[model samples]
Target: MTLFGTTLDAEQIAALLSLLALLVFWLVVLRRERGYARWFKQWEADRKARREAEQAAEKRGASPDGRKGPWG
Candidate 1:
């Protein structure tokens, strides 16, 4: 309050309130952005697929001795 030896007027107070409202609106829109949601789904799917492949490999008695499994 003493930085410039002056006090804020009514217009300055109103401007601050307007800026706060705009900030909240943009934050909401950013939360609904599709690209962010899509990437999360893609990452989850990839993780699931990898787990399934590993489980299938384990079920076939496949060895890590560089030999192909019977499924091939």
Candidate 2:
């Protein structure tokens, strides 16, 4: 049969559509995965930084009797 002034049977059209759908689906999934990974990495870094800061503060805070601890 004729499709868009060219020859393309129903099977050929179906195949082309399937390929396009698959390509688009995979591309979107991969892109999303990459975005998620990047976001997770940033979150991890921020969490680590905050944890380190808290630890440092705890170490630098006054002792039970209000005296500078070892890390002075």
Candidate 3:
């Protein structure tokens, strides 16, 4: 709150404010991810792609990356 020797030094006050800002930043990120925003949507798409790839590899008797597994 005070820049010069006000109970808490400038550095301590700045650190406290910075931590608060970081907390707000994480809260916003969590809200966006939970809301299925574009960023979260990208993750969903990636998961779907992995599922499809695994299914295809299974049919071909291989791993998800197209390499033959031990059973194959």
Candidate 4:
């Protein structure tokens, strides 16, 4: 087959296209996985902050839900 004036056998063309498609597929998958990892990291940080806040509130004799305790 003639592609961009370069002659390639049918099998070679098919192989090249298949490899190109595989490369694109892996790129997309890696992008999505990276995004997921970033999101998860943010989620984990938020969760940690919330836990710390709860612990601090507990030490202050206040309920973690922002309600006053019996003493207050």
Candidate 5:
């Protein structure tokens, strides 16, 4: 009953392909962003640790209780 019978619809195939492409693109972008975010968080933590260490060092050389330091 059909002339040159084709079972698939052209519009449906195109739409499916477009959706697949978008899914792949977003996956790649999200993976890269996640890696960068982890790196940034680690960097911030290291910086804070270093600052706290410096402050501790400064305090150690400071006066004991209410007494002045020897170098003061």
Candidate 6:
């Protein structure tokens, strides 16, 4: 077959298509994984900050619900 003014056999065309598909697949997978990694990092940071805040509140003699009463 002719492609871009170049001749390619059936096997060559098939190999080229396979390589293109693999590249696209990996690109999509890597993009999604990067987003997941970013989200996880942010989640971890927020969790750590919340834990520190809770500990600070406890040190200040405050309950988790912000009430010093026995019910809290």
Clashing residue pairs in candidate 4 (N, C-alpha, C atoms within 3 angstroms): none
* Candidate 3 error regions (>4 Å): 1-6, 37-72
Per-residue lDDT of candidate 4, residues 13-45 (tens digit): 899999999999999999999999999999999
lDDT per residue (tens digit) for residues 1-72 in model 3: 554656787789889989999999999999878787877789999999999999887788745575564765
The local distance difference test score of model 5 is 0.85
Q: Where's the lowest-lDDT run of ten residues in candidate 5?
A: 1-10
If the candidates were sorted by their TM-score against the true structure, best first, what order would they fall in? 6, 4, 2, 5, 1, 3
C-alpha lDDT of candidate 3 relative to the true structure: 0.83
- Per-model TM against the reference: 0.44, 0.75, 0.43, 0.76, 0.66, 0.76
The root-mean-square deviation over C-alpha atoms between each candidate and the true structure, in angstroms, is 7.0, 4.6, 10.2, 5.8, 5.5, 5.7
What is candidate 1's CA lDDT for residue 13? 74
**Top-TM-score structure, candidate number:** 6
lDDT agreement with native, every candidate: 0.82, 0.91, 0.83, 0.92, 0.85, 0.92
| Error at 34, model 4, angstroms | 0.5
- Assess candidate 2 and give its lDDT: 0.91
**Candidate 5 local lDDT, 1-72, one digit each (tens):** 222585547776777789999999999999999999999999999999999999999889877774675755
Candidate 2, run of 10 with poorest lDDT: 62-71
Query: What TM-score would you give candidate 5 relative to the actual structure?
Result: 0.66
Candidate 5 wrongly placed segments (more than 4 Å): 1-6, 65-72
Candidate 3, TM-score vs. the true structure? 0.43
lDDT of 1 by residue, 1-72 (tens): 322777878888788789999999899888778768989999999999999999998867766674785754
> lDDT for model 1, on a 0 to 1 scale?
0.82
- Badly placed stretches (over 4 Å) of model 1 are 1-32, 62-72
